[model samples]
Target: MLYDLFLKPYEGYSTLFIVLEAIAAFFGIVSVWFARRNSIWVYPTGIISTVLYVYVLFVSGVYGDAVINIYYTAMSLYGWYVWLNVKGEGQALPITWLHRRSALFTGGFTLANFALFYIILQYYTDSIVPTLDAITTALAFSAMYLMARKKVESWAFWIACDVISVGLYIYKGLGVTALQYLIFLILAISAHFEWVRLYREQQAAQAHPGNTTTKPA
Candidate 1:
């Protein structure tokens, strides 16, 4: 099916795919953009995007992605509550870095997801686009997990994932999705630097009186 997309170009199919992709991508960008500014609206926008993609990916025969969106929806709901109402030590934590052990666990889990995806794609699904989809899916899972945890390094993972997603979308003849991923690639880079700068100024603020300032806005 994927080969046929390029081997025998289907204009109608491409057009319909582009429409759905655009809707999903738009909300995704909005959510991630809000997230960079430490805004709480990210989860709401993410919910919409995930809901849309669940149907979209399922129709496209990317079952893993479809399933993942279900998880994304659930996680978004959980994160929403956690962000708004949860407090630690009588204060809501703004943002925090992952501990060393947590980082190690994340890396290990990502690797495990990749291995599982590879095995499932290579053997179970007969999807011609399985390998590519699986790779992106695994990366997305890692990136989403980091984001949910409020880790600064999530942007790094997003940069890597979105860059690869661009190539994958373009290869799959999803031109609009490719463009969305391209835009996301740039945003992810910006968010990474933005978060790092924010983290630095935060640390400095703790040391000094009121001199250090880092505004993600």
Candidate 2:
């Protein structure tokens, strides 16, 4: 069972897929690490991972995932620019919480995308596990958008999506990808707390204008 879940990909799946997925997963880890640190490298690393996943998922016939990867790539580019320009005290984009109105919009948009993708995958294609695929893809869309905007709530969406995706990838027989999501789940949880701390520090700094020691950015 251990071998099947971990090592079997090299034998059961195509060598190309194993290699590509591994590469994508590696950079994905890196991207998340950079994101946790609020580093600018996150977008570049994320772009590479998403672009590779687009090809990987498309060839594997997970069209919903492929489409999301494409969306991720575009968002990564936009995020790169956004992060570059939005300067705080030290030229870093300030971390922020989502506004109430933005939160409602995000919720609605996520549900709408889930429904749209579910219908498309169910009717237009012979996609296996279309409902789960649509769900994970939609959550991912929301998470990516929030992250691009540097919202602290993005980690919550990521944590939820990563947990669901662990089961989804396992069900699809992509064991390595399942493992990646498990790691992502852990990272997202940690990132949530870390970002919350950062947000609080930023808030404190804003309240105390003379405190030069706490640079939340």
Candidate 3:
């Protein structure tokens, strides 16, 4: 049973996939670690992971995931530049919450993307789990966009996406990637709290601008 749950999936796959997935997972963890610290290294490391996954997911026949990885790669580059310019001297980009209007737009966009992808994947491709794939892909799109903007709510989307992805990847017989998502879920939860703390600190600093001792950024 254990073999079936784990090793059985690797039976016909190339050793290249195992190696690629492991490397991607390692860099993915590193990227999240940098993100938690609000470091600029996050985008570089994330680009590596997402680039590899683009190939992996494409070969695995998960087209939605493949496309999202491509999007991630592009976003990582954009984010790298944004983060570099957004920070002032001795400060990181301020973590922020989404406005209600922005939140509504994001939510609507995710749903629309999901619906469109579901229809395309279901009708145009031979994808095994089109609905789940579409759902995860849509969530990831919103999460990645928010993360690039240094929004605290991005972690919430990531936490949700990571949890669903664990089951999704496992069902797709990619146990290693599934385990990676499990780790991602934990990191996303930790990041959520950390970002919230940072946001609070930033808020307090703004309220007490005269206090030079408060290191909000």
Q: Clash totals for all models, in order?
A: 0, 0, 0
Error of 1 at 141 (Å): 1.2
List candidate 3 stretches off by more than 4 Å. 210-217
Pick the lDDT winner.
Answer: 3
Better of 1 and 3 by lDDT: 3
Q: Report the C-alpha lDDT of model 1 over 1-217, residue by residue, as the tens digit.
A: 6555443434555666656767898998898888877777889998998998888767666676776788789888877777666453333334568899998998888888878887887788865677776777777788887777678878877888787778876766655556777888888888888878777767777788655333223
- TM values, all candidates: 0.83, 0.92, 0.93
Global lDDT of each model? Answer: 0.75, 0.85, 0.87
Provide the global lDDT of candidate 3 against the true structure: 0.87
- Clash pairs, candidate 1, are none
Q: Cα RMSDs of all predictions?
A: 4.1, 2.2, 2.2
lDDT of 2 at 111: 99
Candidate 1 regions exceeding 4 Å error are 1-10, 14-18, 88-91, 208-217
Candidate 1's displacement at residue 48, Å, is: 0.7
What tens-digit string does per-residue lDDT give for candidate 3 at 1-217?
A: 6688679988888998879988998999899988887778898899999999998889889899998999999999988877766345555566799999999999999999999999999999999999989999999999999998989989988998898899999898888889889999999999999989877877888899763322122
Clashing residue pairs in candidate 3 (N, C-alpha, C atoms within 3 angstroms): none
Residue 162 CA error for candidate 3 (Å)? 1.0
